[model samples]
Target chain A: MHIDTGSWHRYMALPAFLLFSLFFLFPLMQGAVLSFTDWDGFSTPSFIGFQNFVDFLHDARALQDVRTTVLFALGSAPLLNLCGLALALLLNKKFRGKQVVRALLYLPAVISPMIMGSIWYLLLQPKRGLFALLLQRVGVSGQGNWMLSSNLALVIIVLVNVWQYAGMTMVIYLAGLQAIPLEHYEAADIEGASSSQTFRHIVFPQLIPSLKINIITNIIGSLSVFEAILALTDGGPGYDTESLSIYILRMCYGNKTGYSTAVALMLFLIILIPVFISLRFFNKVEER
Target chain B: MKPNTTIVADARKTRLSPRNRLDWYLLAIVVLISCVAIIPFYLLVLLALKSPIGGLAAIRLMPDFHFVNFITAWQRSALGKAMFNSLVMTAGGVGLLVFLSSMAGYTIARFPGKLNRTIFTILLLCMMIPGIINTVPLYTLLIRLKGINTYWAMICVMAVNAMPFAIFLYSSFIRAMPVSLEESAIIDGCSWFEAFWRITFPLIGPVTSSVVILQGLGMWNNYAQAVFFLQDKAHRNIPLSISLFFQQYGADWPLMAAAAFLGLLPAVAAFLVFQRYFVEGITAGALKG
Candidate 1:
């Protein structure tokens, strides 16, 4: 194997660049071009000249979907972060069975959200579901299927998502917590600082960086939630739980490809705006 | 101390005492929360074992004591076939992802040239782009390319999705490694590719394992992409099989539960077998960088 460094570098980079081009870049460019036209996906796309964008702008239903998507993201992201932080705090203390608890909590994060949705669907079924039956046994009668009602459907979806994803956030936070010097906490205690005072001054101050990445990533991910929403609600009960991803999916796959492309582009911008802001925010924090 | 200040200090000390009854109360509350988390999973296991027809009628806080449902679900759903398909796809996808990602990573880390940095930045930016934006176009493109109802379509998508993260991890790990190893190998007349294979690759065993396990579990349990791509029932993967199991046996809670449990096997097994790597893989970039 008479090998040279320079030429080998070229060979190494070649396959990866080609792969990315074929699989990633080309389709993205094609998607951008197609977004401008009316294509049913099967037929040749006719030039529509911003008609899709105009149609998307006027679509009240799409606007509502945007609201619902934001609601889901806002509600779930904070709750997940809090739950993760709380768990990390508790688990950071020396305890028996800590490893087992960590493993169990992280289990749901590894499973696909689609599978989790399916499992929860069966478990949360109103009439014959386990929760329903259990509620009956407890003498607390409930009226409607949780998944059927618009308000409850949104809440349940967010709660299930939090449960599934909180573990990963917890792991990240725990790592952050570990990075904090133990001596800092000790010094705070020596200064007669109360637990809450120590948390505010020492723990929370140090958590800013983790919060920056965790909150931004989780919110971006929360807005783009599609698999679980599709499997569980299918944006049903009249588009109550219809996220932008689901909205775009219905447009792209179900009925209107052109209109959906516009909506998808909007969803991209919505995701991008917050992410850009968050990145800037994080940079500012780092610089400080 | 003065009488008034002494009274206030005594009250504060009582409140702040670590061994107070309030501490026990808080512990109880936390234990209660943990129980709530555990009980549902316990019930799921019990539900999976009960007889379908007898299960709902016999629903209780505890197991109904029927284990045959597992056998029936396994027999009826062709779970074995689905598992085989999932394993094949995961193995193929992770295998290619590791090799390709590490090569690019090594070049970027070692060379650090303008082109490499620009490409790396592009990748890092692409990492933030939502996968949904790519889906509609990717699906249509696949259909046009006649890749529907095929594993290749699913494999390609999963591999590409895993690429950015894999490269990110590999780049960080390679950069952490001393360049002295590569330089030494170069002096021994080994080429860059050969040096990477013999030296750099060996050193990255832990990270490589992490990538394999993390991506492997993800691909194993992946259903959304598979559902869209694999139109045939016989060709559907594990998660889809579990989903179809629900649709078919909606009333049969035991069978559906059993099938879901079976569907969780590979993911559970992967997590257990490579638990350390899984944790490292997840917490690496977020925590360290």
Candidate 2:
């Protein structure tokens, strides 16, 4: 192939670059600058260095939201991986109704998170909740009040997120698992290796790529839990479930765009520390 | 004694959970888990069709199959209109992405230089940063350009959101393609665009499918971005309309369920049509990131 380096080669990338700059580049840079200002999203902005950051530090609710956000994210990552991996393993088999089952499991995933959250909100309400009513049938009281309880609210958010996304990870993991040659497993069987032994030596190692992808993406997704939380609880039960993403929205709607941007930037920075750690960890493992 | 040993070994092999070989117990468990997965959606559908008294509060699983609940929520929220708007946006956005990304990918594959490296690197970085972080300034930028609440604003936003992944998918696929195809065409007096369109474009089936599946679903089901940019009632998509309907029918679970599932109808229909590409798309999208 005699490919020439013509001017049109560069010009071919123009549309992508144009879109990237107009929407992503311009806004991100503008946000960075505005984070150091005192703009209320409307009137002409005034320069106020570090004031937004200072406000983020002093604002107790934002700090609390960060705490709740961490709790939600920390809860979400491991649970999603476990559930997703489990479901993937289960569905990987050649069962009779496998296709139907896989579709059902992914049903929650396809529905809008807003709808899923609201559906769950209804299903978890105290007196009227389906789960609550089921519990009562099994010798408990009325609804369990999962959504209203501060302690349970954050936990519920994690569960709801997992419910909505575990199918995605399961499908991803299924793809990974399918790629592993069956001969390896047959070899393990011929060698008289136990099931757990096979998993430890072969299956787990082969799945690390999928694991890294799921974990990194889930970690980021957990930190940015917004729409579902907003729909589910609205940061209710006294802000026990407010994540930084949700908190920043509250700030934005409160007409403090600069302050919210600063907080969001901080959230991004906080997210980076974990992202970098995981990337390094992933690299080191893959090196082995 | 030998038969007993074989049975013992078989038991050990199927003894574990989650990764267990199938047994009666394990199959039952799988069925139960599948039911757990379906129950919420099942309940949503049943409740959506039930009369007002047979809402979530009732312990019964059956619905009277009333279309009135669907009708009430459907008419009030302008479900059809919002669905049409979402469909148009998704189609437009996905179409634009397929065209531009194929070109970018072609460029990256053929031109292995600093510009390619830089563009690819920046895209990789951009994938990590959520656009929500720039909402304040982005909102202001849209306002300044009179793009707030406009169709162009959302179509462009959705397209841009889908860009990084599209570029990555395309570039990787194109790089792996046989270089001779494009080379032979260009040698035969075809211009770059001409060679790309006739020869190279036909071969990008895999990535184009991924772009369509992933970006199309993304634009269709998105609520957060829509909530931020398309705030006006008339300009909103299905998810936003669903949210409004939820708010309006605060304590009305039957109505809420009906409206919610109605909002999900389009995306679900699309997924059914493109079910094959979806799992493929998710796997590709995740593994690359």
> Highest lDDT among the candidates is held by which one?
2
Q: What TM value does model 2 have?
A: 0.93
Alpha carbon deviation, residue B35, candidate 2 (Å): 0.9
- Pairs of residues at least 3 apart in sequence or in different chains that clash in candidate 1: B49-B66
CAPRI-style docking class of model 2 based on DockQ: medium
- Tens digits of per-residue lDDT, candidate 2, B125-205, equal 887777677676777778889988888888888888778878988888888888787778888888778888899988888
Give candidate 1 misplaced runs (Cα > 4 Å): A1-4, B1-23, B52-57
B1-289: candidate 1 lDDT, tens digit per residue: 6999999998866544432233555566557756766666676787786655554747766676677888898999889988888888888888878878889888888878777887788778777777677767878888888888777777777787777777888888888889888878889888888889999999998778777876777788776577777778666888888888777887777788788888876787778787877887766657544
Q: Any runs in candidate 2 off by more than 4 Å, and if so which?
A: A1-5, A142-144, B1-21, B53-59
Candidate 2 per-residue C-alpha lDDT over A1-288 given as tens digits, one digit per residue, 9 for 90 to 100:
555636676567677978888998888887788888888877888999998898888989989988988888888889889999998988877667788888778767777788778888877777766677777878888545666787788888888898888888898888889888877877787787887898889888989999988888888778888888988898988877778988776676677887888898998997877988998998999999
Instruction: Sort candidate 1 into its docking category.
Output: acceptable
Q: Which lDDT values do the candidates have, in the order given?
A: 0.78, 0.81
Provide the TM-score for each candidate, comma-separated.
0.91, 0.93
